[model samples]
Target: MARDSLIRHYAYLVRVVVGRLVPGGKSRLEVDDLVGSGIAGLIRAVDTYDPAREVKFETYATANIRGAVLEAIRNEDFLPRSIRDRLRAFDRASLATEVRIGRPATDHELANELGVTEEHVGRLRIAAVASRVGSLDDSTSGSEGDTLRFGDMVADPSVDLDRELQDNEVREALTNALGHLPERERTVVGLYYTENLTFLEIGRVLGISESRAYQLHGQALSRLRQRFRPMLMAA
Candidate 1:
C-alpha cells in the first residue's frame, strides 16, 4: 500500500491509541501532541506493515505512537545542572588522574586527587552508573517502556559539513572550557553529557540531594557561560 494513503486510513486509530495511553494529567502534553506523534508513527508503520501478519494495527501503531512521543520528549530533554557539574567533575578528575597515574583512577586515587575522601569518590561512582533508576514520575500517556537511554536518546542532526564542523567546534570549546572549570562545575557538565547520569545520580555522587545538585550545577554553568560567552557565541 502507498504510505500516505495507509497513514490517512489509520490515522484515527493513532489518536485512539494515544488517548488510551496518556489520559489527561498534570503534564502539559496535549492530545494533539499525541495525535501528531501517532500519525507519524502510523506513516512509518505503513511503510513496514505486513499484510499476512495476524497482529492487530493497534498493537503495532501503539509502539510507533509511543516511540514518536518519546522521541519528542527526548528532544524536549529534561536535565538538571547539578547533574552536568558532577559529570564534568568526574570527567576531568578521571582523565587527569588516569594520565597522572597511568591507569584508571581507583576510588581512593580519585578521591585523593580531587582532595575529597574515599566515600566522596564512591558517591561519584554511584552517580556515574547508567540506570533508569529515577524516582521521578516518568509515567506517560502511553504504555511504552519508559526506560532512560541518556546519551543514546540524544539525536544527532548533522545535516552538512558546515553543521558537523560547527558541532565539533562546539564540542571542542566545551571540552576546553570544561577543562578550565572548577571541579564542581566540571562534574555537572560531564555527568549530563559524558557520563549520562541523572540529577539524582549526581546528588548521590556529591553527597547531596538532587535539588542541591541542580543548584550547584546551575551556578557552575552560569559562571562558565558568563566566562566563555564569546567562544560559545562564536560556536
Candidate 2:
C-alpha cells in the first residue's frame, strides 16, 4: 500500500519529467510512452530512495525519471538512414562554414555550403534538435487530464521553487548565453520558451514562415548548447 501510495502521490512528477524531457510532441516516441518510462523511474526511486542521504525525494526522483525517459528514447532507432545522412552532412557543412567565416554559420550559409536549399537546411536543423531534445512547442496532459504546456508549468509559481533554485548555476549560464544571442535568435528563444508560442505562432509574430522560425530556434539552441555543454556535463 505504501509503495502504491507513493507512486500515486508522485505520479504527477512523471508527467513533469516527461514534459521537460520531450517538450514538444515531435519525437517519434509518443508522450504516453515517455510517461510510462518516467513512471517506471519514479517507482524505482520510491523503492531505492535513502532517507538518510539528505537529498529531497523530489530531486532524486527527478534524476531517475529523466534518465529513464532518455534511456527509452535512446533505445529506439527512430530516424531513417537518409535523414541520418543528411544530419551528418549538415553538421559537416556547418563546421566548415564556421571555420571559414570564423563564426557560427547561418542556415543560409550552411545550405549554400551543402548544395541544398534553405528549406532543406531548415528541416535538417529541426531534425537535428529533435533528435537530441524534443521541440519547444506542444503540450502534455497533466495528472488531472488537463492539457499543460511545460513552459507554463515552469512559469507557474506553485511549482517547487527550491528544486529550480538548486540549478542556479545552469540557469545563470543559460541567461548569459541568451544575452549573447543575436536579436532575432534571442526573440525566437523567448517567444518559444517564455511565451510558449509554437513555431507557426512565432512566425506570425515575426512575419516569417513557420519553417524559418524553426530554423532560428534551432540556431539559438545550437549556440546555447555549445555554451552550456561544460556546465551540463558537470551537472
Candidate 3:
C-alpha cells in the first residue's frame, strides 16, 4: 500500500489508542495533533518494517502508534520537581499504610501514621493528583495476597466497567464527592480531566494564570479526597 493510503486507512487506529490512554476527553493535545504524531509513527513503521520477521503489519503499527502518542505526552510533562517529590512521598505513605492495614487507610489513619494533620494529608493527596498524569495503559496494584490490574476488569467488561465502576459503593461515593465541589473546582476538573487540557490551556480558557489553574486543580482534588477517603484509598 502507498504511504498516503496507509495513513488514511490506519489513521483511526491512532485516535482509538490515544483516546483510550487519555480517556475523560480532557487531554491538552488536540485530536489533530495526536493524529499527526501517529502519522509520524506510521511513516517510521513503513520505512523500517520487517516483513522477513513474519510479523503482521497491523500489530506492529499499533505498537508504534501508541508509543508515539505516549512519548508525545511525556514530552509535555511540566510539573515542578518539588511537586513531583511531594507526590512521590504521598504515594509512598499511602502504600505503606495500605500494606500495614490490608485495606485502604482512612485520612485520619494516614495522618496518624505520617505524623501529619488530616488536612495536610488531604492537601498532599490533592497535590499528588495535580502533579500526576493518569494513563489508560494497564497497571497492577492491590495487596500482596491479591493483585488487581486495570486490565483485569475487562475480563467481564460489560459488568466491570473496566474496574472503575466495579465497586458500586466507591462509584456512588465518588459521584457524591464530585457533586460537592465548588463551581470553579468542578469546571477545572471537567476541563483538566474531561477535556484533557493542560494547566496553561485551562488557565487561558478560564482567564486565570497557570498557577491559579494548578491551585484549583489541587484544591478540587483535596476537597474530593476529604469526602471520599475510603473510596480513594481503596483504589
Candidate 4:
C-alpha cells in the first residue's frame, strides 16, 4: 500500500490504542498529542514491516504505536515526583492496613494510617489510577531474568497465532478472577475496562460519589494484581 493510503486506512488503530491506554481522560497529555506520536509509529511500521513474517501487520503496527505513545509520555514525565512518592506511601499503608484487618482497606482506614484526611486519600486514589497509565511501559523480570512489558501482556485482538493460546489462558483466568470479585468491584471493573467509562462516569452510573468509584477501582486492581502475580512471575 502507498504510505499515505496505509496511514489513512489504519489511523483508527491509533485512537483505539490511545483510548485503552488513557481511558477516562486520566492522562496529562492531550489525545491529539498521543495520536500524533502513534501516527509516527504507523509510518515507521509501514517502512519496516516484513509481510513474510507470521505476525499480522495490524499486530506489528499496534505494538509500534503503543511504544511511541508511551515514549512520548515518558519524555514528558507527566506525574510529579511528589505524587509518585505519595502513591508509594499510599500503597504501603493500604497493604499494611489490609494485612492487619484481613480485608481491603477503606479510604478512612488508609487516611488514618497515613495521617491524612479522607479527601487526601481520595486524591491519592486518583493519582494511583493515573500512575497506572505510565506503568504499562514498565519492564517486569521473568523467573529466568528475561524482561517483559506489562503492556505486551495485555490481550490484543491482533496478536499473532503463536500467542493465541497463551492469551486465551490469560483471558480465562481473568474471567474467573472477575467472577470472584464482589458485585460492586466487578461492576466497576466492567464499566472501567469493558465499557471504557471513566470513574466519574461510572460513579454517575452506579449512583456513588466519584471518590467511592475510585476506591472500588483501587480495590479491584489490587485483587486482580494478586491473581496475576504467579503468571507474571512465571512469564
Candidate 5:
C-alpha cells in the first residue's frame, strides 16, 4: 500500500492512544501531533516488513502508533529524576515481593518492604503514570505481572464504602509522608525507591557522580525512616 493510504488508515488509532496517555490535554495539539512518532515507527516497520513476514499490518501498525505517542511525550520536560527513581524501585520491589510471596504484592506491602511510609507509596503510583510519547517500542518493565496487582486500592466486595474510605485514608497517609519530605529528600528518595534508577542514571540527572547519587539516595532513605518511624510506631 502507498504511504498516504497507510497514513489515512492508522491516524485515528494513534490519536486515541495519545488521548489516553495525556488525560487532561486541551486537544489543541491535533492527533497529528503524534504522527511523527508513529511515522518513524511505521517507516521502520515498512522497511523491515518482510514478504515472508506473516504478521498482519494491524500488529505492525499499532506498534508504530504507540511509538509515535511516546516520542512526543519525551519531548516534554517530564517527571523529575527523583520520581523516576522511586518508580524503578517500586517496580523492582514489586517483582521481587511477588516472587517471594508467590502472589501479587499489595501497595501497603510494597511500602513496608521498601521501608517507606504508605503515603510515599501513593505518590509513587501517581508518578507511575506514563508520558504521552508514542510507545517507545521497548517496555520499561520486564515483569509481566498483572498491572492491577496493587489490590489494596481495588474496591472489595464485602466491605462497605466507609471501610473503603478508611483504606484510602491509609493511602493518603502515605501521600502525606511524601509531601512532608524536603525537596531534595523527596527527589532522592523517589529515585531510590519508586523509580529504581541505578545510581548512574540518578547521578546523570542530578549532576553528581554515580557514587554520589547512591550516597544521597541512601542518606535520604535513612532520614525518612528515622523521621517517620517514630510517628508510625506511636500510631
Candidate 6:
C-alpha cells in the first residue's frame, strides 16, 4: 500500500495513541509533534510491513509510531539548564549523605547538605517532575490505559503554534498555582496526581480519611483551574 493511503487510514490511530501519552500540565512534546512522529513511523511501517504475515498493520504501525515518538522524547532533555544543574547537585548530595548515614537521606537532610532550605528542595523536585515526559504505555487514571494526551482537547488546526505556546503559559500558570496551594492540599495533589496514587493510598500516606483525600484533591484541582483560567482564555 502507498504511504499516503496508510497515513489517511491510520491518522486517527495516531491521535488515539498520542492522546494517551499527553500529560496534564505544560509539556515540551505537543500532540501534533507526536502525530508527525507517528506519521514517520507509519511510513516506515508501510515500507517494511508484509501482508503475508499474520500480524495486523495497525498493531505493527502503532508500536513503530509510539517508539518513534518516545525515541524523540528520550533524546531530548527538556528541563531548563539551571534546574538540571540543581537536580544533579541534589543527586550527588543525596548519594554522599546516604553513604555517610548508611541509609537513604531524608529531603531535609539532603537539603541541609546542599545548603538549601527544605522548601527549596521541594520546589526543585516539582520542577524536575514538571519537566519530564513519560512513555505512552504508562497507565493513567480514568481512561483505562490511555494517558493524559490533550491532543483531542485542544484541536485548533488554524492556531496550533499559538496553542503550543499557550501550553508553556499553562505550565507556568500551573507551577505558580501549585505554589499557592495549602501545604496539605499541595501534598495531596502531588501524591495523587503526580505520584499516581489512589485516594485511599494517599489518605493512608497522609493518615487522613479517603473522603478527605478526595476533598483535598478536588480543592487542589479547582485552585489550579481557577489560576490557569485566564491563561487558557488568552490562549
- Taking all chains together, the TM-score of candidate 6 against the true structure is 0.38
lDDT of 3: 0.54
Q: Model 2: runs farther than 4 Å from truth?
A: 2-13, 25-33, 48-67, 70-171, 230-235
Whose TM-score is greatest here? Answer: 2
Model 5 compared with the native: what TM-score?
Answer: 0.33
- The sequence of per-residue lDDT tens digits that candidate 6 reaches over residues 1-235 is 5678777888777776555445433243565676788778778877877666555677666655654554444344433445445545654565446435544456588679988887665554433233332122222233223234233222211112233334443356456777999999999867755576776788889999877886786676556555544332221
**For residues 138-173, what per-residue lDDT tens digits would candidate 4 score against the true structure?**
222112222222233343222222332243444465
Q: Per-residue lDDT tens digits of candidate 2, residues 151-214?
A: 4323211113233324444245446767999999999878766776777788899999877887
Model 5 segments beyond 4 Å from truth?
30-32, 80-235
Off by over 4 Å in 6: 27-29, 78-235
Q: How do the predictions measure up, each by TM-score? A: 0.35, 0.49, 0.37, 0.46, 0.33, 0.38
Over the stretch 128-202, how does candidate 5's per-residue lDDT look in tens digits?
322111112211221222121112122221122243335555456446766777776677656644565555776
Score each candidate by Cα lDDT: 0.49, 0.59, 0.54, 0.59, 0.48, 0.55
Clashes of 1: 20
Give per-residue lDDT, candidate 5, residue 235. Answer: 25
Which has the higher TM-score value, candidate number 1 or candidate number 3?
3
TM-score of 2: 0.49
Error of 3 at 119 (Å): 36
Give the lDDT ranking, best first: 4, 2, 6, 3, 1, 5
Poorest stretch of ten by lDDT in candidate 1: 152-161
